[model samples]
Target: MIEYDSYGRMKYDPQLHFNQGKTWVDEDIDYLIHWLEIIGYEEMSLALGRTEATVRDKVFKLRKKGLMKEGDKSKRHRKLLGRCKDEQAVNY
Candidate 1:
């Protein structure tokens, strides 16, 4: 089941039956990027079943390592082309 905190950030229940392999797949990362493209980092956390802080931390690390591009930092609300919104480094 999808879990949420009092503030609405998504939470995970370790007691819940879990298949680690299925829970943390490459596609999940893609889903996070997709949500990051839609709403923003904070909302992407909820959509991807993680805390906003966790999302931000991961994004920050990825950015620091140059795996995630600045142009892909947030969803584009304007007409800014030539930016890659799909290219991403695999994260495990």
Candidate 2:
């Protein structure tokens, strides 16, 4: 069964998220970059079977490493495009 926190947010479940806490594979990172450009973290999380937080963290690390640009359109305008509203709310 699914579980939620007191705040009504779904808790992380290893059974549901097989990659949770595991090392990311190269292909996974490639797919992340590809999809991240076309979609928001929320959709990318669902597609990658990862938590949204995990996806966001990965993006941050990528940016810090110079793997992703700070000026990337996805990062600059995802909220303006009406994508990832949930993520935007969390950031605020």
Candidate 3:
């Protein structure tokens, strides 16, 4: 259940929070992955009102910690795409 403003916008409903002074929660990671699958990472970042890198980092960290099973290929693909864009940008 997501909270929505009167204008049909999602409100600032944070599923993730710092516990005992700044710690990542598994549930939060799971939630993010779930949404990422549905909306993609960029839109998930927008919906979370966070930067794209932040969201990507969270996924990466979780994968490193074994808190996530997916995203390995996605991460690789993103990096490859980034490199391609950078090369293209330089040539242009």
- Model 2 lDDT vs. the true structure? 0.65
lDDT per residue as tens, model 3, 7-90? 333333344211212454566566786767666664565555554556767888777888666743444213211223223221
Residue 77 local lDDT, model 3: 19
User: Candidate 3: where is the Cα deviation over 4 Å?
Assistant: 1-27, 72-92
Global Cα RMSD, each model: 12.9, 7.2, 12.7
Score candidate 3 by lDDT.
0.50
Q: What TM-score would every model get versus the actual structure?
A: 0.45, 0.62, 0.46
| Residue 31 error, candidate 3, Å | 1.7
Model 2 scores worst on lDDT over the 10 consecutive residues at 76-85
* Alpha carbon deviation, residue 42, candidate 3 (Å): 1.0
The C-alpha lDDT values of all candidates are 0.50, 0.65, 0.50
TM-score of predicted model 2?
0.62
User: In candidate 3, residue 59 scores what lDDT?
Assistant: 81
